[model samples]
Target: MAYTVGEMARRLGVPASTIRYYDKEGLLPFVGRSSGGIRVFTEKDFEWLRIIECLKKTGMSLKDIREYIELAMQGDETIARRLALFRKQRTVLETRMAELQQTMDTLDYKCWFYETAAAHGSTEGISDLPDEALPEALRPVRERLRAAAEAETEEV
Candidate 1:
């Protein structure tokens, strides 16, 4: 069924402007237009938009997406290249998810330590924290934040 841009937006739960922007960006090749120049989308077009949304959510830049579309426009000749791009994105996403999970685990450990220390009235010195204390990944982030705060205070 043919749907207006607004209808497609409502159906996809995205803003109409986003759909229009995608059309303008050549991300939607089959988007139709009415005599009055309003975008008229079809079910197939919405399906393609859903794919575009999924790609965007995977952190694909518009330029990369455009490149992928261009490759797609070339038919099956670039299938290998397209697969390589998707595989690379998948690998990167997996790495990031692992890192985030590690950080979360470290934060949870730190929270447990704090709870235990607070409950035990051990407010003496924090230097006795276990040698394995904070995860190496989080130490740099905390250091950077502390540095930024110190710099901000100096700026004030």
Candidate 2:
């Protein structure tokens, strides 16, 4: 079934302007134009939009995504190249995920630390607590924070 740009945008949970911008950027080349100049999207266009959204969320730049789409348009002969591109992007995404996980772990540790402090009247006795009182993973982070504080005090 053919869908107008607004209908497609509503179905996809994106703004109509986003769909129009992607169409202008040639990202939705599979979508056809009506005789009256309205964008007419097929089910295939929805599938293409899903791929575009995934790539965008994975931090792929517009130019690179456009190149990937061009490769796709070149037919089965470009299958190897497309596979290679996806593999490279997968590696990038894995690295990013790892970094984000590490950041989240640190944030979780900090949250626990602050909550402990808040439980007491003040933060005065936090450092005096034993490492066993905190999560095992947070030991090194706390040590680093303590060393930095000591160094700052010494410098002053």
Candidate 3:
């Protein structure tokens, strides 16, 4: 089915301006114009927009997204290049997810430590837990947790 730009944007939960921006950036290859120069979109447009949203969410820059779209418009000639680009993006996102997971794990551990220590009324109990008890990557979290715990004790 065909849809106006505003209708499509509403359905997608994105700003109409963003849709216009995508068109202006040449990311929408089949975008059409209405009689009064307004934008007209089809179901395929919405589908493509969803793909664009996914790419953007996966951390692709607009320039790269446009390049990908340009290559996509070329059909099968660039399929390998597109696959390679997406693979590279996937690796990046995976690395980011790993780092974020480590940070979240560290934060969870700190929260648990603070809760437990507070219940016992002493941050000193955590002193001998060893500097490298957790990942070296967690050292920063440990320091932040220690400082926060100390500050809380002082406030008490």
- Candidate 1 residue spans exceeding 4 A from truth: 121-156
List, residue by residue over 1-156, the lDDT tens digit for candidate 2: 999888888988999898888878988777788999878899999989889989988888788788899999989999999898888889899999998987787797779878999998678988689999988888887886778799999999
Candidate 3, residue 15: lDDT: 93
Which segments of model 2 are wrong by more than 4 Å? 143-156
What is the alpha-carbon lDDT for the whole of candidate 1?
0.78
Model 2: what TM-score? 0.87
Deviation (Å) of 79 in candidate 1: 1.2
- Predicted structure 3, TM vs. truth: 0.78
Put the candidates in lDDT order, highest first: 2, 3, 1
Query: What tens-digit string does per-residue lDDT give for candidate 1 at 80-104?
Result: 9999989987887888788887678
lDDT of each: 0.78, 0.86, 0.84
Residues 44-75 of candidate 3 have per-residue lDDT tens digits of 88888999999999898899889888888889
Model 3, which residues run further than 4 Å from truth? 129-156
Every candidate's CA RMSD:
5.7, 2.8, 6.5
